[model samples]
Target: MRGLTAGYGPVRALDGVDVTAERGHITAVLGANGAGKTTLLRTISGLVRPTAGSVHVDGTDLTAAAAEKIARAGVAHVPEGRGVITELTVEENLRLGALLGSARKRTERTAEDVYTMFPALAERRRRDAHTLSGGERQMLVIGRALVSGPDVLLLDEPSLGLAPRIVSQIFGMLRDLVRETELAILLVEQNARSALSIADVGVVLGLGRVVATAPAAELAADDALRHAYLGF
Candidate 1:
């Protein structure tokens, strides 16, 4: 995204946002609540139309395209709420994601692959999604997104409302996922420390604008920046 701008009605949540999530890397978008982190992902996924700038995957321009069109273009967004079909079983949820994925990915990444990635989910494959714990639900949603075989994965607050151990497990899995595949992950999080620990690069936002953009370690090491914008 370059010079991306979007909002809800008159409130501009994202203003002139410039970001690039490269393949094989995790770019963490860190900020306090209402810092426009969610808007960034929504705009890129075409859920919120951008009033300015462009969003492209590989080489195709997808500015203001339909959400479904963007998904087919290989961008999968796992929103903050750990969204899943409560009525479906663990395995069924993954299969649904694969079916909605691009035709090529349906064959490339299957539900079995997701089960392999998250063994906890594999253990509960037959259970309904609503029966899982908070951490398990988070894993299930991410696993479902992975089954889509997206080139770019947008994850919002994956660590929210989870224990430290569970957060570490999920973050470690994300780090390994990018290392093993060409997939790029744009992670949006209020948990700056956890996000920076696994991210290759960091982009900090404040009041709908980028306050800092640098290597994740550098940002993590900056005491003033962390306290000022990151809040941890």
Candidate 2:
């Protein structure tokens, strides 16, 4: 996105922002609360429209597109809080993901692939989503998005309240997914240290704009930036 600007009422959540996510790479967007990290992903996914700037994927402009249109364009968004359907069984929830606009064929094989990616969900295929732990719910949500065959995945604060071990496990899988599937991930997280450990690149946002953009290791190594924005 270039020159992106968005807001709610008179409050500008995003201001003249520019960012990019490459295939097979993980770009971590880190900031404190209310720094516009969530707003960045929301604008990209069309949940919120940008007042200016263009959101282009492979040369197709998606800035003015609707949320559904953007999803069909292979940009899937997993909002904060896991966004799982508590009433639906694991399999039912997975099926809902494929029901959306997707270019690939949704077959039993595809369902099997999702189960393969998340064995815990497979074990609880018949169980309601709310029965699962926080980490399990997170995996289920990510696997559901994968079922849609999206090229770009925008994940918001995925490590919110999970244990460190669970967070590590999930981040490890995300790195592997990027390498194996060549999908681009834009990870928004308050867990700067964890996010930088696995991310290929990092973008630090402050107030409503980018303050730093660099290689993940470089960003982590910068003492001033880390202390000022990363809270580490």
- Go through the candidates in order and give the C-alpha RMSD of each one to the true structure: 1.2, 1.8
lDDT of 1: 0.91
Q: Provide the clashing-pair count of each candidate structure.
A: 0, 0
In terms of lDDT, which candidate is strongest? 1
- TM-scores for the candidates: 0.97, 0.96
User: Candidate 1: worst 10 consecutive residues by lDDT?
Assistant: 102-111
* Residue 205 lDDT in candidate 1: 95
Q: What is the lDDT of residue 134 in candidate 1?
A: 93
Which candidate should be chosen as best, given TM-score against the real structure?
Answer: 1
Q: Considering summed lDDT, which 10 consecutive residues are worst modelled in model 2?
A: 101-110
Where is model 1 more than 4 Å wrong at Cα?
A: 104-107
